[model samples]
Each structure stands twice: as C-alpha cells, then as structure tokens.
Target: MAPNFGRSISFPLTPARSFSKSSRHVRSVSLPGTTSSHPLLANLHAHIAAVRSWIQDTASLQAGLANIHALHAALADLLLLPASVAALRCTTSNTGDRLLDAFLLLADAHQGFQECLLELRQAAAESRTALRRGDAGRLASASSSQRRAEKDLARLAASVSAVSTKCARLNLVAVSGEEAEMAYALVEAAAASAAASAAVFSAAASMSSAVSSCKKTATFIPAFARKSTAPESAEATVERLHALEQCFDECDGACDMVFRSVVQTRVSLLNIMTPTI
Candidate 1:
C-alpha cells in the first residue's frame, strides 16, 4: 500500500559538502539572509539533510492502514475470549476487534501525519537545493514524495480557503484572502533560494546559506496557510548562488503570509461555529 516511489535519490540537488566560495580567506558562518553567523543555522542544515533521508524510507499512509487491518484479524483470540460465556466469545471478539480498529485509526492518523510531515520537510530541503543551484525549473519538476508535499500544502490552503469562505458566509472576523495569498507567495518564493547569497534583509555578508524546514513551515502555515532564514559550512560562504536564494526567500515569504491568513480566517469561523467546544 505504500506509495510506489522507489528512486528517492533522483532529486537533482542533493546537499554538497563543497560550497561555492566567493571569499576564500576568512572563515565565517550565518543564516541565509542574516548578518552574522548563527550557531543554530549551522546545525539546522545538517538536520534537514538527516530528516530528508528519514522521509525517503518511511512507509505511506495506506501501507500503515493495511498493516493495522491485518493486525486486527490476526489477534482475534487475544481480543475475544474472557473465561465466561461460550456464545459471547465470538461476539466479544467482534466487538473488541471493532474497538481496536477504531483506536488503530488514531494511530494511523498520527503516524501518517508524521510521515507526511517528513515528506514536506524533504520537499523544503529539495527546494532549497534547487534554488541554491539556480534550478527553478528543476524545483518545479519534483515528483513522488516532493510533489505530494507541495500538493499537501496547496490542499491545506484549499481547505482553509473553504473554511474561510464558510466563515464569510456566516459573518466572521478573520484575515482576508488577499493577505493569505501574499503570505503563501512569500513561502513559495523563499523555498527556491540560493544558499550562497546573503538574505535580502540582512546587512551582514557572512551568514550561512542553510534553511530549515521548520522555519519554512512556521512561516507559511500560520499566515497562506503563513518564512528562512539557510547555513554555511566550514571556511566557505555559499555566496555564488545568490540570485536563486533571493528569489527563494521571496517565495517562501509569500507562502507563509497566505497560510497564516487562511488559517486565521478558519479559526475565526470555527470560533463562531462552535463557541463552547
């Protein structure tokens, strides 16, 4: 039942140990756009690579569900027979099986969401790699898990959009669609940035070119649905890849704004719909 995505390593821009160094003398580190070296950004890039690797191996939601179902049938005896009534044995088994199945769905949802999150995280990393290499078209060509992750965000946006619409129809106060779209655009823009370039907002020159999936998710999820700050390596500045990273930042910012606005609108609507819950 797992997604039939076998060639995980086919994505064009895997992390490179050798960065494109413009200033080959002084050793400095910082986030993608910031002025100074951030200790956090350095670790962040490494973690992103690890997370992406983990995602490549994780099973799909359907595979998990199928496993859950198989477990229910295989464990019927353990589920059923109390030392009491003979006729009640089969009935108890059925009831227990149903209850267990219900609980397993929760497990499935939790695990599935985690898997989806991994996919999304990898997508962010992949996007960063593409942008750093000045490969926007390559970023667009992402597929399998990456495609699913992009679709997931867009779907999240669509759901929130629907919720916002319902809110407007029901008369609620929330962020506007225009604002949401802007946030989404920022996130999408930030996604494909070059690691070698300093942040457009940064005044400093030696910041690292590494960006985090969390930063990406946090920025966008709240605002289209709501932002990077990438890292540098030892004695190397990822500056040669500026053009793409700059564009990446803008897109990332856009996505963030859109996510936040939509979510805000939905939350407002939910409050109106269920005041006590």
Candidate 2:
C-alpha cells in the first residue's frame, strides 16, 4: 500500500532545470553580491533563489528532502561551469585547497547521514512488524535502534554545521574581478546548502521520536498490553511507522544524490589545483 502522508507534498511547479548556463536562456541578470554578468553565475543565483523559495514554502523534512539535495547538486553544477573553472584557476592553490577541505567535510557528513537514514528506515520497518506480531522484545530492540539512529543524525548535523562555518570563513581578499564574484557565489551556496542539510537532519531526528507513539511503552510491555496503557491506537501507531519508513527511504535517495554531488564538486576543485600544460 502507498504510504498516506495525510497532506499533499507541494514541490516547485517549474520543471527542474539544469544548473548549466548553456541549458538556460541568457538575460541581463542582476543579483545581490554578484559583480559580473557571467552567465553561469547568473544561473547559480537563479537556482539559489528557487531553492530559497522551496525552503520558504515547505521547510518540513518530509517535503524539503529533494530541495535539500537540489541545492547541493546545484552547487556542484555551478562548479562544473567554464566560468567557474576559470575563476577557480585564477585563485591561489591555497584558496582552492581550503574549499576542497570544506567539500570533504560535507561529503563525509553526507555519507554518515545516509547511513543513519538507512538504519532508521530499517528500524521503523522492524518496529512495525514487531507491533503487528505482538513481539515486545523485538519492538524494544527496534525502538532502541531508532533512538541510536536519531543520535547519529544529530551528530552528523553538527559536522555539517561545521562545514558551513568553515566555508563562510574561506576569505578571498586577494581575488579580484570574476574570481572575487565566484568566491562570493561559492561560499554563499555552500553555506546555504549546508544549512539546509543541517536543518533537515535536526528535523528528522526530532520527527523519529515525536511520531513513534508506542516507543515509550514498547520497551516495557507487549503490544496487546498497551491497549489500555498506550495513548494512541495501535492502528495509528502502525500508520506512523509506515510513514516514517517511507520518509526515511525518500530522504536516503536525496542524501545519496547530495553526497555524489559533493564528491563531484571535490573532483572539480582538485582539477583546479592540478597544473595544466
């Protein structure tokens, strides 16, 4: 059965556009913090705006998972552009190296977050099965697993925040012209995308504890015994478990996308550090 999430998931009406400037129509684009009429930078700003709009519309973890991925993937796409490549090449190797370190931190955190999601999803599914089978011991084990996954997510979120902070501190005072503008854009996107990822991590952690209605009693008593003791109906708890499982599955897919994007961005940064003959 399809998981019923009780409400409609609203997404951006516009078809997801490529972050490549060549794929987008060029116009005289002007944005704050931007100095040049560079087409790639313009596209970057537009993508950032779209992501900001998504965050404003629906910041909930369930609804914003794809947006979180989109923001990071857009950052990677921005780095792949010819203009972005030229800007990176113009900067000192030290600056490029620092940005590369930030991306590595993000990539590590993203990988950990994906593992947490997988564990959470598996625990939620096991919990549902235990509840259905009236197996108190199994339910308790599953609930413990869920809590552990939530804690892992919380820790991973802290790492993501640190990455954002690191990106914000990468000052490029010596860079001028298009390099300066690209530096601004890169740092801005990194901070924003990391913030989005961190917010979702926090949200997902809280959501696991909030919706698992039987968690408090599942450790103590059998599901049948909870008929009078539990605050919510067994049916409802089952539905919530199913929802959590689906949500985690969805987030995991998005997390994988963001992780790959982070890796790609790092590869591009490495390319910048490499000397071309």
Candidate 3:
C-alpha cells in the first residue's frame, strides 16, 4: 500500500557538533532479541517487546504517541546523566554543592519520567476501555489526556537534550587516563542520543497520523464492506505503519549504542571514584 495521502513527513539530519578534539565516532548498535541466550540481552528484549505490546493494545493514536514520548524521555536521561555526572565530578568550582545539585536534578527528572509513564499507562487503559465499548465521548476524553501527556513528554525530551548539549560543551579536563576514555565515550553517547530522539519524534508523529487515519476509516468500514468499495485511507494507513516500524528499528539501534557507551562511562566513573590505598 502506497502512502498516497498527499502528506509527507520530512526528517532533517543535523550534523553532530564536536565537543572535544578526540573526535569520537558513534555507530548504531543492534538490539539483542529473545533468541539470545544472554540474560541481560534477553531481559532488554522482553522489556522493549512489552512496551510495544502496550502501545499496540491502546487503540488510541495519542496513547501510542504518549508511550513513544515516555520511551524517549527515558533514553534521554540514560544518554545524558552519566556524562553530566562525570563532567561535574571533573570540575573544580564549588565541588560539593554542585555535585549535590546535579544529583538532585537527575533524581527529580527521573521521578518525573516515572510519573509520566504511569499517567500514560492509565490513559491508555482508559482508551482501550472506551474503544471496546464504542463510547465516542470517553474516547475523546482519553485522547485529550493522551495529548497532554505527549506534550509533557516532548517538553521533557527537549529539556534533557538541552542539558546534555550543555554538559557536552563543558571543558573539564579528565584527571586520569580512564577518565579521558570515559569522557570521549560520553560525548559519543550524547551525539547518538540526540539523533535517536529526533528519529523517535518523527516516527511518533507519523504513527499518530496513521492511527487517526485508521480511526476515520473505521467509520466507513461497514459501508465499504457492504459495497466492496476500495478504501484509500486504509491503504495510506498501511504505508504509514510500515514507515513507523522502520523508525522504531532506527531508534532501537541508537539505543543499543547508547547503552554500550553508558556502560563504558560507568566503568570509568567507578574507577575515578574508587579510593586508592
């Protein structure tokens, strides 16, 4: 099915700004699936699958967008926090208070993300119920709630990305060889995170449009079914879904790379923080 709805979505790629002279290259990594025997990888695969299933179950377009927004928020935190913490540690200005402030902000952001996820889940459940009962009014109410959640998620993503860019721009010198490596890795992670979030936002927008189209087409289904009429909207929805799925794949790859970089950053942080006798 071709997406001939005369509407096109464009994703503009911006070159990642280099923050250091080392020039770290970030490559997209493949996500591990359930077929993998490794416990960690298997668990990750299960977690992603569960989230995808939840999105699919919600029938509301806005609900799906809300889920994607939440997912992006989580990734943004993952992408930014380690580097922020590491950079803060390397700084010589107002050490103790700055460290405390950084951690507090991180905690607050994390808590906010969790709360948003809870709200989105509840909204999705309400949407599912309304859809099943064919209650148009309830569905509309749920859609409004989901839209608010989506906006909140978008705001959160933007805030995190801005903080990440700031952290990357900081010129703190690494105290040790291991710390330098970690700093470079953090830069790469930050770049990958920015690209991944963009892909997600684009995909979410496209999917939301497709879901709305699907809803509109549902109203005409009975008429089309009786008369054997070809539905152009249905075909357009299929095309959008295909594109959305591709975007998901790109996001997953970016996430995998970010996760690996995070691990590197953590190991370096641990080494720097450990007391040496």
Q: TM-scores for all candidates?
A: 0.24, 0.76, 0.42
Highest lDDT against the true fold, candidate: 2
Q: Give the whole-model CA lDDT for all candidates, comma-separated.
A: 0.28, 0.65, 0.40
User: By TM-score, highest first, what's the ranking?
Assistant: 2, 3, 1
Residue range 1-277, candidate 1, lDDT tens digits: 1232222211223222222222111121212243213333233333323322322332232322222232222222211222211211233223222222222322232233234345544544555565556464655553244545433323222222222222222211122233222222112111211111111112011111233232233223332221212233200222322332353343343333323432332343233323474
lDDT of 2 by residue, 212-263 (tens): 6555544455658666755355557888889888977876666777788878
> Which parts of model 3 have CA positions greater than 4 angstroms off?
1-110, 173-179, 190-213, 216-277
**lDDT score for residue 116 of model 2:** 77
Considering lDDT, where higher is better, how would the candidates rank from best to worst? 2, 3, 1
State, as a TM-score between 0 and 1, how close model 2 is to the true structure.
0.76
Model 2: residues with Cα > 4 Å off, grouped in runs: 1-34, 53-63, 80-83, 90-93, 217-232
Question: Which is better, 1 or 2, measured by lDDT?
Answer: 2
Residue pairs with backbone overlap in model 3: none
